[model samples]
Target: MPARPHSPCVEAAPNGSFFHPDVKEAFMNAVTTEIPALAHDAGVPPAPPEAHRTADELRDIPLKRLVASPYNVRRVPPTGIKELALNIWKVGLLQNLIVHPMKVGARKAQTFGAAAGERRRLALIYLFEHDYIPADHPVRCRVVPVEDAVLLSATENEMREPMHPADACDAYRILVEAGRSIEEIADLYGVHPKTVQRRLKLARVSPKLVDLFRTGEVKLDQMQALALSDSHDEQEAAWFDAEPYNRDAHAIRRRFVRDEQSFVSNRVAKFVGVEAFEAAGGAVRRDLFSAAEDAWYRDHALMLRLATEQLEALGASVLAEGWAWVKAMPERDHATRSQFRPVLPRRTEPTDEVAKELAAIDQRLAEIAAQWEADDMDDEVAERLELEEGALSMRQDEIEGSLLVYHPDDMAQAGALLSLDANGEPVIERGLVAREPVAAATTESGENGDDDDDDSSDGRPARVAAPAVKPTKGPHSERLMLRLNAHRTAAVAAALAQQPHVAHAALVHRLLAGEYGHSTEASALDVTFRDHSHNLTKHAPELDDDLAFTMRREQRRVWGGVIPNDSDALLRWLIEQTDERLLLILAQYVAASVDSVRPDERPHAINALIPALGLNLADAWQPTKAGYFDHVSKDRIVDVVSAAVSPSDAMRVAKLKKGDAATEAERLIAGRGWLPEHFAKAEVVRMKLWDVPAKASDAEASADEAEADEPALAVSADDVRDDAAVAEGEGMPPRD
Candidate 1:
């Protein structure tokens, strides 16, 4: 730099007479130009030189003086113009619009043509149209060269990051907290008032959940669901309890509300009617984020009370209709109604006028059906046919219903069951009669031996007992008999376990029975079966909550997972299994099928079987105060304690309160190996001796002596009877 030219970019320091050497050199190199090198030496063509332009100046110009650029790429929607105008009106222009001076002309006298922020320009026009701003209002603008305007507009429109939803929510909330009305915030942000409201709702979510949303751990919809509840505890609980993989909006909402909330769409809620329920002081919780059906009635108890009251009122109306009795319940499906015998409605012949109307309706329905059957029919034609058919069918149904009317006499003896159908419509089950006991037949005789006599000569009918009819049972009632046979089968199973020979014999007998006997009577034992296969109507509630039940359910779940879903694959897998494994599997199946009467049902048979199987009930069954003693009578509790400990111990607890006694009884019976009557084994019967001839009497006596010298085998006549009854295809003997 022998003689460097003065440069504007490089300035001399106050203490120095010349600029810095590096700064001066950089400025000289930037200003100096060089010719291209030889092609052979350069190897490639040189890039074009960088362009230089003067910096644009920002200026405030009149709104009318700024005109939209014809070459602008961004198109602002018409609806957005109003929102944009509101935003501009509230906050003023956030960024200056890029514009260039327009050439002066007769028709075009505007000051500049807008490139960037065309939407802002349109928004200003909107404000002018809406009388919010004067026509010549001043708008901020960046004065750029004409060529740079389109590039600036495209760059401004394309290069920007969207605001994170959480950030936006927080921003909205901050604005709200700063004393801004929702409408004001909406106007400032160019959003709907509802949008602002929703953002505020989201902002009210628990801080922890909001943090999770900010970190992207929770989704937008999930956050919305959490925001449905104002309680921080509920929001946190719902978020934490939700399955990570299945944290859907619905699941999140369900977790937040739980069973405490009942949907308005639910049958019970519909039956009660939302208006009536709310009138009864039930609070209805609506999801601001969802549709109307998503609303829930928070007070379930109040809703139920209202529903019950309405149902009872309906029942009263039915009772007033000369019925013997009326029952109102929440549920009255076929399963419930089947418990009662329905009195058949007396049939009546239709009157001539009604018959003619029914015939005409039926003919019309047939014609409509024929018309509807046309393949080339238009949608309108098909819809018309359907409407006509529906009308005719309704008339037909009315006529048919009128023909089947109950007599007043029958109604007097029978009753009606009132309940709500699936759609919340009233379902009246009429002509339901109470189950009558089966009565015994009576015989009458007169002095002249006439059958029409009311009484005998002694003034009483002879009390002759009716001959007993043997139960002709051959799978008469599958479900009832299955339960009855299950008990007998359990007892037999316990016996057969001790005597493997008996098991083998029973297996062979079952196979033979299948081949020779009826298919339905193939086997008494349900060896291949599943647990909880049959739906039990009656059982202790604790059975469901029992630890053993839970363990069994988990075991079944594991086994079900390992088992092949395809039948063919399962068969193949079974064929591939070792004999020992197969036997173990079979044992599990057999054990699960031993649906010995539940403790609440006829448990005597299972009680008898337990000891025979050498089962230590103490190992499997522990009597808790709530599970056992609490449910039993005080006398039973004392008896249990007495049997387990001593009579004194029993007497000590007998004077205590029932609950205290139960607790004490439980402690006493803990390790005593004592069981309730339902669980205790029945007495084992001994084999009977038979009469022998005198010649063989001495030998028989010697043999009997030898048998007496050996240990006695415990057996039961009831067990033997059960085995016989099973083999004979007859119903089991009644339990004692």
Candidate 2:
């Protein structure tokens, strides 16, 4: 690659530099090459034999005329339509869509059904609808008869073999070596430059590993893993060191990342900014193959120490603000803070000047709201108006909120928490009062017999004293418990989705087992599941790194890759899936919809499957100062500590300040297999059957799982025969 003018996108790399100079040169060379063959390799049908038609036969047909055909056999929707659309929009369509003349009503204009290239036609339509392309965007197409069109469509999807990964990588390498640029190759192949870069890297893996891939001894994923490292020796070492059965793609990747902290995902690393770490002389390793959201931080201790120092500095400032104490914790999850009481700000009315500003802002907001209700507005105009309204409303709120300040007495009693937030910025939680002694619990809410009823609800005693009632009941108010329940429910749903057998069992129990003889509705199934991702994320943002969250994310990715976009195609495609595959996805969807997050009740039905699903809430969640203990009474923390550790340990922590007790409880509870009592599995003697040996039936019902495949769905040929009628109504003329 020759020198070029600077580009800001170039500075976005993890290491603040683009690829190696050699890789840059290769990308430059690949960019210059024609990519017609690459596009053909990627699902576009090859040109027909010249003997069938002249060059004139291949014509530019309007996109609207190139409608989808019913006879196009590939029912499964291909993934990446938006990506494909963007590529076509940028470089124009490469391959001709195989279209056939369709029979239509006498009054209707002539049109063609795209039998072979439905995906490309859809891409063109997407572009046109988005105004990226003209209203009548011309799609390059080959005119064929009805029977030939069907044959071409089926053959292009089924008969044409995709280029082998090994061959494709080698081809990319050759192009790069022959002075082609990545942009040119990406444009020709309808892919991102990074994709070409990935292929080139794959080609550069240990030649021996490439040979293994060629011989089918190594899989494509495994090859991709080995390509993570540039050193051929390191790649070979990783390959040789792996035990045969353990040599999966993830395993290979783990071998490389074993010692390094996942900086992107690790909260502490985010808290200690990347540049700060580097300035502190810490080493960072950027993975060139992956999207650089975060790189491998080489020194874990250094990262932690850096975070601690920053937090400590922030604590000093908080303490100076007259807080009784300032606690600086490294973790972003402040679950333990649930036990602490929050001191209310003294809400003396705003000053005259601030009050005037607030009134003016509120008046403007009312005017904007009235205008919004009265007028039908353009999207841009509405957006602009909405923004102005939001700004005014925010200004009003700011003025009012500023009046509610920490009173001198409240600050004298309450401490502050100086720690990292989710985004890694240091934030100080003010007016935090550690739980007062048990004697003070009745009046410790700082209300002094105040107006708000909810204020009196704070810091209810977690448990009774030496008489020792079961400590599971927490001191949290109903509303806060509901929030916790929402998070837990989301986690359970995620867990349930991963275990198809358990999900199936839950379904069966709900529909049959519970109805027949079971006394309790302990199955957790409401007989329906809905994707509550949006709701759950809004309620519990901390669930972002949760195992359940990750599992659901992966599930979405997997489904997106194979499922067709068309509803008709989806039905056909689903009908075609294997029993196991169908059951797996069914379990995921069903599990996702499960919601037992209620403060009034424990998740008994959902918890019953804990052992069966091997659901570990401990792994998914941790008690933190802010997230858990802060919302509950200090006694709850002590109760948990006692149950998880010992009575002596609980007593020891009980003597400390509520915040300190919570922090201590978190430490004691770590790796103790203790979760919030609501998550505990309930004892169940369920599923009484109407017939068969009672003991045998009960034993079978209680068994961990039945791996039996779901019965195959039988689709009558009659169902498919009517597809042509359905196709006709959906833009396609009567191609049959």
Candidate 3:
């Protein structure tokens, strides 16, 4: 037989340690244990949730007759009682109190214990004490048995949930508008002052954002971030007036404080010092809501004025260097900047100590380089070495420049510029020579007469809108074209390397047009003579099969092995070679300069060069799964299959998945000599390089513009791609 459980004992009344359970006057029933009789194996069913209170009778009990139940579940310090009192006073109690008769000496007692709603009972007492309600104010009560009182109280307290954060904020806002101070509200709710402030902050946010918060469009944290701004107009502007990319919590905070003067981290503010700016009558506002509490500077014009005055003082000090002029420019105009040529100082002999320092730096740099000999290095080590090298190089440059001075003649002909750098340090640029028209560009020794190296500071005023991320490109990315173009460039160079005649014409045409003032004319050969072989290597990847690139590399390898290593020895060897062998090597170098990387379309001049060398790009390259099929869209792969194979084959490939389709297309296009559209289109050109018994005598002396712009064609090779890249941000600087 199972033993029966002991009956539960109830503790007497409750809180500041509110609601003491050990009060002597409170009533609680005595505990008793009873054994149950054995049953015939039929199990009893469970009772409904509200079964304990279903039989209780509703009664209009006077407020004075109700007492807090010792069996009430909540025992915390009395909280929200004042608000509860105010609500009951204004609207009357909406919920009935759960209570039981407290039998005294076997007689019905006038007072009943409130098993639930102890807080409500307290609130009624509060209103009566304050004269807001009568002592015998009628209160609704559900009278239950004394034995069932604790269960009903526990259920009511445990089942309720607190209000939402947004609602709480609005509640606080209501109290504030009703003439309650923040401290009063904090004391009223037993919360801290900052809690009230934060709640009120949300309440004060843009009403549109408030609507967003209510509708779940804006989150609580986002609303809190927005509340940092005080003005409704500014808040709306920060949210709505901002760029689409800039409409986020972090960006909204930045846009609200758009005034340049108040930013404590501004370069000008940092340069002048926040204390100094404030002393100079600049207003500073501290954003307490910000995590870091960063300040904003309010005086834009004042900061600029102070920066200019300080620059003038700095410039005046530099005038002692005997410069022809020293100008202090808060903002250097382009017209003023254009007047002078940039100059790097000439270094004189360094002192013994500086020489040792330079040697130490060189030794360290060599050590790092030696350590970096491995094909792959640790990322941490690489990053550390990069930082170390940068610092060491900067120090080395400073030490090397320490011995530099302007020549007295140069100083007489030049001026110095004084302005602030990005960090707001006053930087002085000395030895800026005025641009002068000269009879010759070279000295008697054939050395360069100019000394310009063209380096300048990123000079600008404070304040910029938050930066936005660049939108992503389509599937046919620039990277794909860059790789393809790199291969094309390599092919053109390799082909040109074999054709010295084409190289000769291009070089001669460029030199004649540049030197002799044929400015108005365009050339069929618009090629520059700068080496971009490194750029070609940099942009292309997976180039083990680029035939022209491989061939050019092999040719370089062969020459590199055959040529004399020493410059003087090489010169002598070059002089000894027959004109044929020498022209071949020289033409190889000239051909390497032929960069024809246009992104999608070929230049009109390059169009002329294509046929000149009998260059066949189709022979040089072919599409493979990895190279072409994988990168293109499914539709494009199908199109390729249709073009290279048959429409039926394309339809079959299209039925397969993307990856499988690409594989099938690669298989179908393998033996077909079909090329992509970019490669298949080319215009025929005609060129007449050398004159043959022209009617005019000057025609022998000079080539005409008509001959250069539109030349007669060489051997034709059709179906070659013209998909080279636009210049990679660098071409020869326009001679203009």
Candidate 4:
């Protein structure tokens, strides 16, 4: 073959006689394409040459001879390099670095520059500096051609995804299960010990919840809440019981453990003291991941027992003080022990020296107050003065306390009551005399005609006959009154449902109450309705377990579920809703805030308004054992039965036990449209629309005008009917 001249694609430089022209193109054209076909015909395809070296090749390269490439895609921070160094020292290099032979000047020694793993090279340098590894120690690396090293580095750094959190947790768990310490695992992975522990904790969560987390059904924070409990049953139950919107971390935590545990910060718990309760074998659950104060004590029964025992022990001294009797109670309420009259403690004059000290304290307090008023004091001076004032006040209190003592005679006749104060401290109410004995003495005096004497040497007050007047109607039993009010409230709700204009006016009344009234005294009619029903839950020990509260809570939950979650969506839905549906919602709100009783100032107003609204109390209310009949006295139960059915039926149950009588009364009045005096229509001065307060009327008038001007949209009338029925406890569907 004859030699050919160079192609024009590669031209000669101006100064040079000759230069390579189109060398690459010439080379490609010169090579024959039949090589692969010839190999295939021979029943074997030619093997492609390797583009890059594998990790196995060039494994033994000296650390001193390896230098970091200037064009590395990833850079390791200085602190990260130190941590990486420690990890490499502990576990050795697990991944091989990619490197290529570096082209150096004549003065420099031959060395390999890292292409893909600059962090590993830096870590090796750090090890050498720390004397953990020799400068010339050999490291494992995969060597590639210099021209291809940058591509390999970019691919290695960018192509791979970080490990998924669940997978990482599982891996940590596997290591922990294989007898590796948390510290050891942390060091190997270049993370904190807490990080490793958290991952391991996450791995131990209920398997089903873990699956949910992996599938994105549950979030990481929710998973953390589920991990709070080791019991899979509680975890699974919380997940299932929580509504979709209520599946937040806090809600999950509350649902998981609130019922089973009581916080140490509770009044009863503080009174009992966590130390003493724990001493008595009551277990406390503490969250290691949370703050120290965030702990709960389990076994409420045991805690209560410990508290009662402690209270009794403390009350022993009071009982020994010649008291007629000593009563110990968990809380101090006026109603519980109001029948006993408390004897005032006799105040004795302080000793001359003590009196002088008190006078000096008073003088010092006066001086400080005068100085504070006269001078523009700095904060430090003011703080010092405050401390001095507090100290003097405490001293005065101590002196006053020491001077007061109970008389022996009074202590003999009166009793002591021990109770926990609001701050959970033991308070002794001393010298309380029985009202029954006082009343008996008065009765005996009347019988003996000694009540006429205004002056008696015995120090007892003379009794006088009360002025005669026409007898007023006796009050109904509390249960009966509550049942009556419930009926009235239902009637009010139904009446409001039929009239949207009145409903709108009532809503305006609530809005004005909230806007003009104090925040603490704001009307309860703002959201739903406010009724006396919640009062029944206030004193109940098991508030969450109460039938009424539970039922009401579930109803609220259903209401919440149907409401739009997004604010804009809710606005749109409200805008599109019909007047009847809106009225039905507003009626529920208005009916809840009704307070039509004698003591309330606006009772006559509500009474007059009820008739105008056509509220049918009998049709809206029915008494049930749980809601009413069971809580009444046996005589009251008999009275209710007598009023509803017959006197014979009342007499039939009068001889039975209270529970049995109540049950009978409930059955007798099951479907009867019986209502108490409070719910019945009464004669009262009619209230005009102008009777509303001037300020309130103006606000309401504006609101009414606005509502009237707004156009109403179409809504399902069936929906309004369903809501009214639900509110009145009539034909509501069973909750899921």
Top lDDT model: 2
Considering TM-score, where higher is better, how would the candidates rank from best to worst?
Answer: 1, 4, 2, 3
**Distance from true position, residue 2, model 3, in Å?**
46
Model 2 TM-score (2 dp): 0.37
Instruction: State model 4's lDDT.
Output: 0.61
What shift in Å separates residue 415 of candidate 3 from its native position after superposition?
Answer: 5.0
> Poorest 10 consecutive residues of model 4 by lDDT?
685-694
Model 2 Cα lDDT, one tens digit per residue, 591-686: 766765555433244555555666566766777765777677888888888888999988877766676666567767877767665555333322
* Top of the candidates by TM-score: 1
In model 4, which runs have C-alpha deviations exceeding 4 angstroms? 1-90, 97-154, 176-201, 204-209, 228-258, 269-298, 309-360, 368-736
Report the CA-based lDDT of candidate 3 relative to the real structure.
0.63
Worst 10 residues of 2 by lDDT: 460-469
Looking at model 2, residue 425 earns an lDDT score of 68
Candidate number that wins on TM-score, 2 or 4: 4
- Give one digit per residue, the lDDT tens place, for model 1 in 117-158: 777899899899889999789888877654344455565777
What is candidate 3's lDDT per residue for 216-238, written digit by digit as tens?
Answer: 87777667667867888877876
Worst 10 residues of 1 by lDDT: 46-55
Could you tell which candidate, 1 or 3, scores higher by TM-score? 1
lDDT score for residue 234 of model 2: 88
lDDT for 207 (candidate 2): 89
Deviation of model 4 at 290, angstroms: 5.7
